[model samples]
Target: MRRGGAATRPSLARDTGLSKPTVGQALLDLEQDGLVRPAGRTSSGPGRTAVLYEADPAAGHVLGIDIGRGRLRLAVADLAGTVVAKVDEPNRCRSASALVRTVHDLATGVVAQAGMTLSDVVKTVVGSPGVPDRGGRMLHLAPNLPGWGRRGLLDELEAVLGPGLLVENDANLAAVGERDQGAARGVDVFVCVNVGTGIGMGIVVDGQLFRGAHGAAGEVGYLPYGWTDTDSEGWTPSTPGILEQAAAANSVVKLAKEHGVRNASSAREVFQLARQGDACARAVVEQEATKLAFLVASVSAVIDPELVLLVGGIGSNTDLLIDPLEKAVREISPLSPRIAPGELGEDAVLTGAIATALRAAQDIVFDRRGENLVTQRSGVNA
Candidate 1:
């Protein structure tokens, strides 16, 4: 079933090196259980056209949700991994309770748009900004979203979304999304650097997602830049990390202010001004590019990945920063990892969440083919 496309019984037998009778019997069982359905017949060949079998679209459903500082996105997909509906909205909720209600409403609406209900969803994966602690009780390193790091938050989410819900770091999901379908496809070792309102990284090594011992492997925003531990007497513990404070959206606006660019509220506005030949804005962008280049050098010096994918709202603006970033990195480091804009854009996290949910749903569905039968059946690698 990992083929992800329809295949005939004969093809399945050939691919798995199983007998035709075994493949036929497995397909029959899956069909009877409503987990597999007949697709159209194959093109005419030597003798007769063979019917193709595919995972049943109606047998199971999954939901993917991306909860970000500025927006909330949701997508509904079926057992076959086809996305049927998607929705995005500005995130105005200030409190955790409001965020939970919003998530439920958005998920319900998207599922309804796909002609299904929330109860029909077999698994749900949420991509967010922080890593859950060892006990899965609280989320840490998510200062942008107020009231999100409190204890018992995961329990509250599970209570509302059911036991099949999972929470993952948004950047990690973005890397998975890219690896599965976007710029990082087939690249074994790469880094996805997401620069938006905040900064983070998603590391993939040896064709697998590498979450460090504490599930905080990619939290590069904490890298010390302008700030140091000896000068931390007046710094707030919850303040934005050093590198993030120096390079993210707030820093852009701060740099703009220092250079006398008036009335620009957002980084997007700053970039626009830079494009219009504003010298101050241009300087700010140069500084941002230089900081990002230093970040890339740091990463390249450590892991030496094959590629680096720049994602998120500010990072994806390839027209403005790509050239400068490349030049800066080349100047500072001997290692040269190809840096490219994320192809999936805003949908990367949602796509990744859906992909993860689909895999989990498939595992559950296939495991239900009777425990003994799944294990004893010849060449049935379920």
Candidate 2:
């Protein structure tokens, strides 16, 4: 519905089999309200150049917030889905109320940087590490954050930011973000899996994000499968369990202790040691890759997506994952989906939030077109 990105009304009408007059009228309605504008005249043919209209990139602004385990991000974007400004900082709040307040303050600063106000902001989208209710508030069971699943969280957000705000799972937003303006541009059905301090997935089907009943469809981190002692045929049972629990940056640090590799503080250091031919580090990475491959295989069997987009701090590093992950999936499934690292890097979720807000606002105009046509037909009959 947001017309700025691609295609024109005349071309759209031809594709939809609708009369040019109908399309022109719809375009006029959208333009009158400062939503879309005449960008320029098309140079196809001679008589009269048709004026091309696009969604006005400056019509309104949107704010996106991604709250992670130890960090918080705030970004302001235009209708063109371009991030205009952003802020990232470590969260110092200990309670949900304090976090909400901090977010509100950050939003205010972001808007000011964008040379706008809350009234100029069409909407705000927040992405957290847990499932949000249908109404887009109150995270339910975000294990990374203590006491996050309590009730009234939505009410609190509304009370602080006003209303009509959207809250989404970070992985879900990452998936949507990738499809909208990131690596999975033409992919309609794909799963976006983020590997970081924790693991999670976002499912996109039929060009729309598929949020299951209760809004927690892609919770792959707690898939409940684990590695056991002793090798069993093709699969190594005793190697490691879920990659997030065993190979995540945090997990790698924890696993290092068991190997008597003391004073290793970060996942980066573990990878560095592996490259240096440290026995313990190579074992850790291989063990992690094997577990990840199994998880990818399971996801492929269930989703059968065209592609599986890997993201987050760990998944984006294709140098470390692509080969082993591909091999693992091929070992079990014949129809393995193409695996690729995230293209948008860390900004995928932020970009997705802006796209989400723009879609909601633009859908308003498209929804009215159908109703208006029906009314006109009824009037003509009368």
- List TM-scores for all candidates, in order: 0.90, 0.79
Write out the backbone clash pairs for model 1: none
Candidate 1: tens digits of C-alpha lDDT, residues 151-220: 9888888777778689999999999999988999999999999999899899999999899999999998
The C-alpha lDDT values of all candidates are 0.87, 0.75
Q: Report the C-alpha lDDT of model 2 over 26-92, residue by residue, as the tens digit.
A: 6776676666688777766877567777767776777888887777888888766677888988888
Candidate 1 lands at a TM-score of 0.90
lDDT of 2 at 280: 88
C-alpha-based local distance difference test score of model 1: 0.87
Q: Candidate 1, which segments miss by more than 4 Å at Cα? A: 1-5, 9-29, 42-49, 134-136, 228-231, 370-382
Backbone collisions counted per model = 0, 1
lDDT of 1 at 38: 94
